[model samples]
Target: MEATPRPSINIMTALLLLSLHGFIGPAAMAEQPSISADQASLLALKQHITDDPEDLLSTNWTETTSVCNWVGITCGTTHTSRVTRLNLACMGLSGTLPPQLGNLSFLAYFNITNNTFHGSLPVELSHLRRLQYFSVRGNFFEGEIPPWLASLPRLKYLFLNANGFSGTIPESICNVSTLQTLDLSENQLAGTILPLIFNIPLLKVIDLSNNQLSGAMPSSVFSESPLLDIDHSSNSLSGVLPQNICGNLPNLQGLFLSFNQFSGGIPSSLSECRQLQVLALSVNNFSGTIPRELGNLTLLNGLYLGVNNLIEYGSGGVVSTRGDVYSYGILLMETFTGKGPTDEMFSGEESLKRWVKNSLPDAVGDVLDAKLLSREELTAAKLECVSTILELAAHCCTELPGERKGMNDVLAKLEKIRTVLGQM
Candidate 1:
């Protein structure tokens, strides 16, 4: 009879148990949302086959997690959830760039410079509309630059230097009106400079050095903007340089045109750029008297007019052989003190060389940069090495060009000094 009443299996009780199971079962476990397309793109990059695999890059990469927490992935300043900068410079990463990087729509700065990356630049990068600073220099990338690069409306800096890239720089590069810096130096690119490059309204820094380019120096360059620096050195470019170069560029600071065939009178209008700091025109065919107006450039720090047919003039209206020397002395002071010359004698070639040579005997505490002087904890051996460097520079600046050591010798001496310093 008790079996008949068996557990009193009431329907209500069974229903209650079922309801509890529904609310407290394994099926109730929370599931994260699947990785978005942007995250998937990043994951694909992690799978790239590298010649020398970096285990550190893969330690925390996972499909279901936020990439913002990944190493080397810098997040946005305002919104930490989005990646803004990707700096993998000098990481020894070797692989074709994965197109998946374009998925990072908010990325503003991306630098993979000084790596072993090889292969054509992926056109898919055009999709990163917000990119501002993009640099992949010193890599083994080979191929024509994709024209799609010009389509990035927000790009401000682009550097593809020291790569194996071959072909003329695309004219479309100049179409990015907001570009502030563009460096395509040390490549196999050949052809005339694109005229459009001079037309960019915001371009401030440009380096197209060590290429096979040949043409007349564009007069329009720096004609419309406050370009601060320009380096077209070591190209086959020939012809007289543009006049009014510094006049047009009020903020012109550094100008490098060394190792070219440019010939003509130095532009007198250069004095207009009072902010000029470094002017390098060495190893060219420029002739005529050194513009006395150059002395007006009070902010000038490094002026390299050597190896040219430059005649110096003095304030007394006499042609002075010390003119070139004077400029060199200014540069020496700039390099040594990190400051402009305190007196005109420091701007004279012979005077500077003599001063440097005589000062070597008592050089330790006073001759060195003041900033470096504050380090009283420096060892005697370290001071000796630094004094040796100064001595070498002094020798290199000898009044007689033939007696002066060559740059190669100067560099070797500097290297030896560095080795000694390193040991100390």
Candidate 2:
């Protein structure tokens, strides 16, 4: 018969009820830290971005938006809703990273690859104990790689390549037991590689190429490691390669040592790496006949042995390293075609050997350099001699190193060809 009288409350009681029911406006809620530490850190980074040509962060990342919804920001869903991953790769965003980024205690994966971010990496980054994958590749970041990076207890992949980072690679980085791949290529890093780097138990790949590193390789390097790929090319590393290079490295897949000052005979034990797919030893000062045992590497696909001083076995024996045959084949092709293995005309799958091998028997004239023989000098006898040399080279370039021709056979055939040419 009567509606219940509405209860009256004081202004303070009304405000308390609204707050308890979450009916208060953002202006009131903002009084108690609406922005999180993660948001603040991200904002600090945004302030350092001098150029955001794509407006990726400039437009999407704002205080009005939820930090988790921002572009390139991924927040955790299962547990605490904190920033867990920050990936801004290839956005053309130019900026130096802010030290406040270390405040993202939950950050796990961080990548800024192929951007123009420059300046030394802030030491505060070492605070990211949960970081798993950290990459800053293809940027202008410089200064010595900080030793504090080893402090990341959970780091798995670290890519610091294609930058201007100078100074010796910090030995302490090897302390990361969880590191799987460490790529420091294409930098200005000098000094011999630290032996401990090769000893990390879980390390699978080590790329130290295209730097200024010099000095002999550590004697204990590569022994009993699980490394699958080791690239030390385009450096100043000298001294004889270890005779037992493939020792205990059952998983070795690629060994790139090109464009260095490495000398002495290639280790015959390289044949032990049955899984080896690519072996690059070109542009070095290696001498002595290649070990015939290399032919045993049945899985080898990419073999680079050109530009070395490898010669016929001084013993004049029929047995020669299988690698020597491949080198000789490449040499023969270069001599006739005047094209180096690194010729601009050759790249990717197309190589000097492949070019000559494909042109053999019928299209010999096509591969011959004009400097090698003038049109008038290209008589039938001369053409036959040239063809024989190219044929020998093709045999040396066989896909399987073991299946390639021996140097003894190659030398004899070459001598006979010369004899015939001289008589003609």
Candidate 3:
């Protein structure tokens, strides 16, 4: 009787079942219903990273884990897993980014900031049609930014700063019509910045500072961009600023144009930047007195007018903006009061500092901007805040240059004021 001739020859059913379910091993995962293209793409990126001392990639990205379960990889949940975000910023990961990263066609945010990754970007990265935020700052990446950069129609928020990238930024960079923030700062990039860069409608920041960029910022470039921040500082860029630099840019917030060859008066049009929070025009060839119109930038919070050829303004016999601490003090006084030193009310003997100083401590209401006094909510806490700042400003503008507080003292006091005011 024995064993009933062990069930046998079920090959047809086995074959059918295998076809329905497909392969499931780690090897088969390289293909079909198991691990998808997105997984393989990420694994390829992980392979190039020879040293991730933190074990971020090695411990998390393994066969037993779903790719979505791995750190630094976000996948869409609605469909089959597709990588959407890959951020390994400041992770001490070192290696080249291989072209396989392009296979993650659905990735939108990619940042490898503050790593030691070297070599040029892979051209295949352009395949990431959905890429929006791409930053590789503080890396050793060199050579021209990949030519395919222009191909990503949805690309915005590119930060290639603090890298060794050289060569002229390509004209095709303008092709990324959705670009919002373009920071090519602290690179060896040369050649005149392409004029059309400032024409991109969605651009919010243009930071080409500390490059070898030459030539004038084109007037046409200023016509369309309508950016919120522009920093063309520390370059060889020369030419008078456009007369209406702030007209088209109604939302302009920060303008840093220091340490260049720009020679001319600070444009009277700067008064038009009503929302400007900072105005840095130091170490340039800008001569003549600062335009009286500049005092109209009521929103200005940071003003760096030092290190220029402000000949008429100085202490001792020598003339220099740096030595003219009194003028800086006056500038500070005007900033808080929203009144120029030469306002019509200030007569031959009267001055902005003197007016504020006389009303100090008890009568802060008389010196602060009317807009500030109008806050209505400034019960006791905020009014006390105002008194301190104005007092500091008045101290900065004391009669003798030797008597005035040093800038470092002023800076520390301002930071204290900001902290006390809960603005820091």
What tens-digit string does per-residue lDDT give for candidate 3 at 1-424? 6867766659777666666687434433544543467778888988999899999999999867888889988887644567789989989999999888998887899999989999999999989999999999989999987778989979989999999999999988888889999999999999896878878889999999989999987764556456989999889989888886776778888888877888877788889888897787766787778676877888775666755666555434644333445545565666578776446787421366678888778887767786455657656777787778777766665665566676678778878888877751
lDDT of 3 at 367: 75
Could you give candidate 2's per-residue lDDT for residues 232-327 as a string of tens digits?
A: 988999999887777778899998888899999888989999999878888799998778898799887667786677864321244445655666
Worst 10 residues of 2 by lDDT: 312-321
Per-residue error for 261 in candidate 1, Å, reads 0.9
Q: What TM-score, over all chains together, does every model reach?
A: 0.70, 0.70, 0.69
**Candidate topping lDDT:** 2
- For candidate 3, the 10 contiguous residues with the lowest summed lDDT are 26-35
How would you order the candidates by lDDT, starting with the best? 2, 3, 1
lDDT of each: 0.74, 0.85, 0.79
Q: Which stretches of candidate 1 lie over 4 Å from their true place?
A: 1-35, 52-54, 76-80, 221-223, 312-393, 399-424
Candidate 3 has an lDDT of 0.79
At residue 181, what lDDT does model 2 achieve?
98
Model 3, C-alpha of 101: deviation from truth (Å) = 0.6
Backbone collision tally, model 2: 3
